[model samples]
Target chain A: MAAESHPGYGMRSHRSTLLRRLLRYVLLVATALVVAFPIYITVVNALLTPQQIAARPPTLFPLHPHWGAFASAFSTGHLGIFLRNSLIVTVTITLAELVTSALAGYAFAFVRFPFRRTVFFLCIATLMIPMEVTLVPNRETIVALGWFNSFPALIVPFLASGFGTFLFRQAFLGMPGDLRDAAALDGYGHWRFMTRVVLPMNRPVIGAFAVFAFLSAWNQYLWPLVVTETNGVRTVQIGLRQLQALSIDQTNIIFAGTVLAALPIFVILVVFQKQLVRGLTAGALKG
Target chain B: MSDTRRRRRLGEAALGYVFVLPALAVFGVFVFYPLVKTFVLGFYRTPPFPNLPSHFVGLSQYGSVLTSPAFLDSLWRTVLFVLFTVPLGIALGVALALLAHQRLAGIRIFRTIFSSTVATSVAVASVIFYTLLNPEVGLLSYWLGGRGGAGILQSPTLALPAVSVVTIWQNLGFVFILMSAALQSIPDDLMDAARVDGSSMWYRFWHVTLPLLSPTVFFAVVVGTIGSFQAFGQIDLLTQGGPNNHTDVLIYSLYQQAFVFNNTGVAAVMSVLLFAILLLLTAVQFRFFERRVFYGR
Candidate 1:
């Protein structure tokens, strides 16, 4: 706007505009490089020999690419076991969270209730408490129930996320109330209305949430680390951390393992980033 | 106000609780119950699993944690880590949102690129970063500092900040996304009017944009501060609070005591401390957000 003003202002504005444009280009490229280089480095190192990796001023691009590290990491470190455990944990958690939170969100948004606000607020209150507060108590309960080192310990506790419930509830609230009334008048019961009328409309939000819940379960480290001491139950994060300990000098294998671990999540984000951003703002930023 | 309508409302209320039932039950069992048990454990001398040695020794774990050098070091480092990341994160988030708000072409690619990290787990990310930041292997160290040998993660003095930078970088996307949405919702008329009144861009941002977007910023800050306080994965993977426990955060200390050394009681005390801090911050967030937030719509 200023660039279209008076001569002096216009000249100054033009200079600044060019400067800002240059700055933006510089920053975008730089930030992207920063975001991508770690992945790139891991990929490169995964294909390089250990001695090549240890070389001072290591090769910017791997001179001769090899896949020995990847092969070894997969076979030796029980990465296969970790991947299976991760897939089972993440998939089960995602499905459970989606169903539980969706039903809960629907009831909160549409169903008539006396203490509705109180219940919703209490759920919201849970969001404020840092996960740290509950860490020890949860372990104690796990120990008490003899649920330690079990999948149920991982699955049951996080079945319905407060964040996911809020997202679905907000989406459900945005829908017209008349849709439900129309369904009811057509002889649809509550469950039928929810399934036939409400749920189909809420797919995008649910898709978004499924992505989020999966990410949460996938990225979740402390809970998995704390709860599952056995190798059979550990998540990829634990698997990767173990690699850190195992690889002291030759980091090529660790890098390969890291890349393998991050690949699935990276692909998902590249595809679903828009929905993820929208879903995040809708639930977290909005009142 | 009719009887039938009142009954319907009552039914709805019951349904609300029912809908939220699974959440409350899980949260109670997994979150609250565990939290209380941890607090109680903090006060007691831990017995052998089936009860060979146990007692209700109040405040002793707290005393021991306070006296122990490791706990103090961890607490201090966590505070420092918190100090650098929270304000810096908010600032970066706000700035990115501002940048993204420009009516420039091809900006969505930048947005997507930044947001890409959100899907990444700490394990994967840490592993990726640990290699990229390896003093010998990393590309960044050279441009950042000459010789670039013994980079930030390796130095005890620099380890926390290095970890903080990665966290800030990783989290910047979500904050930017949230704040950009908030900024976008602000009407163009307001900006035009301010410009007609000859307000500078800085004035427009400070006087107009910030007030309208404070709620989003506040939300970001609260989440950021709480997150920074509870950060564990980065330190564990990258630094291990090593080179003399320079970067050991509170959560890592808790993990060490609880799992590594089996000082469950001391770990429990520190968890309560972290919980208390979180509770205080949450209360403060509600107060600030309530008073300062502007609902433009």
Candidate 2:
């Protein structure tokens, strides 16, 4: 009788646990739906025509889907050109930051120099000077250098990053000291050691900073909006703004442009999810 | 042998400087020079004509710009924006993190959904919200009674709050990621022990979870404060500091003064003031909140 009663109690607890799990799943799915609602709506509207978009109570789904808006966004809206410019600018900035940061980080970690502490301090101090404080003067410099409406205007100011330098420095400092000693014993100098040993060993950190640099450069708006005057150098962010301003009435076209602009970032986020998360959390968690 | 070693050491040190020069040059030309220029420009007033040279006003411009009604109003608006976005963002982030922190199957997909907004640029986010809040045909506008006549973005009183909603939504993913990472760092043993103590879920959350999550929460507060203070994209894209300048935060006002009105001196003053405010806020947060944050080591 005791054993039978114990089994009944166990079954009841199991049932309750299962019910609780079901409830948790329901909450998760519901929240996910809510969070993704805007993106979903944007995509749906992107696929619909203006008439369908203006229908009363709104169209939640694309009953008559079409890709004409995307084609128009690329051709007439010049999103294709903007996207190309953004790619060149983002890639250049990312690669430049990685190279500069890696070199600087390596120096700070392993080499000895005069005013080493002072120079390192100066590099990191740029982090405190918010970009807004420097915007007016940077724009002035850009105009003075004849870089207005040019790739240099968009890319030059962002080629080096204090955050990236700090990240790489931390990563290098965390490496085992004997590895460097071992490399040195083999007659490997700083460049060789960095290229062959340090760079190969710190792939994760390098990848993390790359993801970070790419994201920031791609997302830049204020500077690009201020500097670029034509489609030749305008980035996708600025292109989206122009599209919206020019075609405010055409909701589908604007939505299509937005999707086009955000598509690459989405792909990057999914493909480099681990590194991106690591890079983002690096700032909050480490400090 | 010792002399050669000393010479080699000097050579290595010089090489180190070579490695660091490129980065330093970039920072010096772009960051440091511009910072000093902003300060200098703040002291000089630009004439009405483009070709006319700026005159040195020497601290008077600072005095006037800092005390002007426009500056004060914009400052207030910026403060309001910060207040509206930061705490609420952090709260929502924590809630989302807690919800997705479960060990259930296929939870990774939900976590991805929760953190998805981090992928949206400020421009993309502003556009999304702009469409959703459009007066004539916006779904959100229709549902929320903002349709037909001057939707939320066009309403003077509702405009700032509407912009804030977008800011909060855009930043939600970042805060969520931070809190989620912090949550994962917390050990299971601590939570299991709390459960074993027969404490209610609420008690465990308050006493066990929240305290451990304080540092990241504090980090998010600092980051969110700085980000919110400098918010310009959404303002530029959505309202253009419109509805009678209701949403004209400091950054937008500064942009207008510098670019639109060509008031470099005034804009530079605003920039310096912004820098000072951020510095003070950061220092204060570090001093005050650093003590309260539990390391949990």
Best DockQ goes to which candidate? Answer: 1
What lDDT is reached at residue B179 by model 2?
A: 85
RMSD of each: 4.5, 4.5
lDDT of 1 by residue, B1-297 (tens): 999988877776676677678888877777667766877888987665635677789987688777888777787888788888888887877877676566556877776766666655766777667766766655566446656445778786777788888887777667777776777767777776777788888998899989888877777777788888888898888888786788888998888878887767777888888888788877987887878777666
Least accurate stretch of 10 residues (summed lDDT) in model 2 chain B? B142-151
Candidate 2: residue B53 Cα off by (Å): 3.4
Tens digit per residue, CA lDDT, model 2, B1-297:
699999998999999989899899999999999999999999998888889988998999999998899899999999999999999989999999988887677878888899988888999999988887777767788778644434789888899988998999888887888888888877766777787787888998899999999988988999899999999999999999998999999999999999999989889999999999999999999999999988778
Off by over 4 Å in 2: A1-12, B1-3, B146-150
lDDT against true structure, model 2: 0.89
Q: How would you encode candidate 1's per-residue C-alpha lDDT over A1-287 as one tens digit per residue?
A: 12111111223568788887788788777866765566566688789887887666767697679888888788866777888888898999999888878878888888876667887886776776666777777776788889898888777888878888877888889998688878878998667888987899988888878887887788888888888888888877899988876654657788878777887787877778666666666645554
TM-score of each: 0.86, 0.96
Per-candidate iRMS values, in order, are 5.6, 8.1
lDDT tens per residue, model 2, A93-130: 99999999999999999998889899999999998898
